[model samples]
Target: MKHNWTTTKLIAVGAFGVLRVLIWLPFVAINISTSSPLLLIFSFFFFSLISVFSLLTIRQFGTVTIQTFVEWVLELPLPSIAFMPLLFAAAIIRALVVDLLFFFLRTKEAAASIVCGGANSLVLSALTYVVYLVMGIPGTQTIPSAIFTPIGLLLASTVVFDLGSTGGYTGYLVYKKMANTAVMRRIQGAQ
Candidate 1:
């Protein structure tokens, strides 16, 4: 899709991107402090939902804009400096996966949202593991040897896929409600 990056659209992307970071930062901080798996999973859901919402709002290059903004935000903090490269790559990969899926699926319908969300989550998780292995991060071996097995991979994939799709569905519902409002229409230039 050849989208013209008008000033209005650039401003919209910047606005929505800031919104995404504002909403995501607290969750990330909490998850980092607590090291809770449940919080991590919830964060993924929120992340996907927000990304999808931005995509639906912008109607083009939404994921890319938000992901770039997110990486830029992370880069500013000293604590995240070490992980910036990996995080940036993962964010870009996830954005590409979602955008490409949207392109191939050719619709912003619930099903496409679900697939995009699921695929994005799955790719991120896979990349995390790859980074762990390549970087030889501590505690890599204790990830349970079974998880390397085919059955384990399948089970893990299934759970992640379900969580992501559920998130996507939730995002779609939220977008629908928001999109119906006059404020959202004005922001989207649909008015």
Candidate 2:
């Protein structure tokens, strides 16, 4: 089906984009200050929640990806220039994973959300490490160096995957609830 880029849809996308950034700012500050991987558990949860919610609500293929790019633009001046590239890549890859999964799976079920969230988190987390390694940025351990080993990688990946899956499942529940509301019905009808 061909989707129209109506003014209302554009406005909704921009609003959700800003909401994603707002949800991320505190997590970014906490992660930078503490260098704690644990914080990412919450971050990915909300990140996946917002992404899934936007996709389900808008029923648009690029909704999450576009919102993420908007987020990247808004966040450009917040972090150091060195970290911007990693952030840019993460945003694109995460959103793409979610979008592609939804597209291919051809269903907005909870299982799809779970997979999208887990895969999105895992891919971006690995990408961060790879980018850091390639750039050789000193004094930056995206996760603890001790966790760079095979066992550590496995454990960390499992934790993040669970965190993201939980987030996505919760997002699906929230979307389901919101979908039943009059406001959501009207908004969706307008689209």
Candidate 3:
């Protein structure tokens, strides 16, 4: 089965954008409206940053830009949506950083590139998380959230790494081997 990602990719991006809104909707409607800095950051700002950064990275490395852009537009109408101006601003910054890493930093190996991408993403996430704390959000929950950011980064990194790794190559090689050979022989034929 070929991965004709044009339509499938669009659908996936849309679903994830909706998921982003769903995850934050409750936080905005219930908790973050009170103007607490921490609340605002967690429930709204930081998450939007993460979403934009993630989508931008995908667009850069994969052929998913148009789909990502559409989903991002859809997200703007969300009740807790952060201001559009800021989102674009962050997107621009994220894009530049990604370009720097992809062009200036990465070597030929997919694993190294993925690791670099992962590190950059984690740093951005951490910066967003810290911004939340600086706004006076309670560390009780926010603190733990920060701790998990690196782990999330690691997970994303591995997912991308597996995309073109030796393991992935090995799997295809095995499949090819099975398909390329067809034998029907009886071991007792000589008896």
Candidate 4:
């Protein structure tokens, strides 16, 4: 089906994009200022949450069009050219996992949300390491830092799981409730 441009869709896209930024900006700022990965746990969780939010918002309010993706990219404060590959890769992974859960598996629940969120975290994190490798970023890891890095990352993974599952499950439930309410109202109106 052809999706015509409409004001509501434009608004929804813009709104969600801003919301995603609002949710992420503070943590990102902190991470930048401190130059510390200490907050990486919360950052990943928030990032994954917004990533899932982007997918759900797009699915509900906009067409799966290049324009939609472009709008999202334009709305956010992307870091740099070096980050684009990871960003795009994360988006693709999230989209694929979400599509698989909702379209093919017919899962619109917590499990699906958690899975999508976890996949987003895993893909983004793994890609980040790859970028570091390419850039020759040295790991300043002493033995303790090395030991803690994986532990920290693992803990961050749980954040991804919790937030993703909660957001996905709640968002789907709310959407269903609203849809059902609309249907019921229509039926009543016809009566």
lDDT of each: 0.67, 0.73, 0.42, 0.50
Q: State TM-scores per candidate.
A: 0.80, 0.84, 0.39, 0.59
Off by over 4 Å in 4: 1-11, 50-72, 75-83, 136-156, 173-191
Q: What's the lDDT for residue 32 in model 4?
A: 60
lDDT of 4 by residue, 1-191 (tens): 11344455555556555665566567657656775534544655655555454444444322222332553576456663323565566555544554555444333544555665666556555555555556544441211344358787677556656655665555555545554464323322322
Model 4 deviation from the true structure expressed as Cα RMSD, one decimal place: 5.9
Q: Please name the candidate that would achieve the greatest TM-score relative to the true structure.
A: 2
Model 4: per-residue Cα lDDT at residue 81:
33
lDDT score, candidate 4: 0.50
Write out the backbone clash pairs for model 3. Answer: 38-137
By TM-score, rank the candidates, best first: 2, 1, 4, 3
TM-score for predicted model 3 compared with the true structure? 0.39
TM-score of 1: 0.80
Q: What is the lDDT of residue 151 in candidate 1?
A: 100
Superposed Cα deviation of residue 60, candidate 4 (Å): 6.6
- Scored by Cα lDDT, where does model 3 land? 0.42
lDDT per residue as tens, model 1, 166-185: 87778788888887787666
Better of 1 and 2 by lDDT: 2
Candidate 2 per-residue lDDT, tens place, 118-151, comes to 8777877777656656776443555577777999
lDDT of 1: 0.67
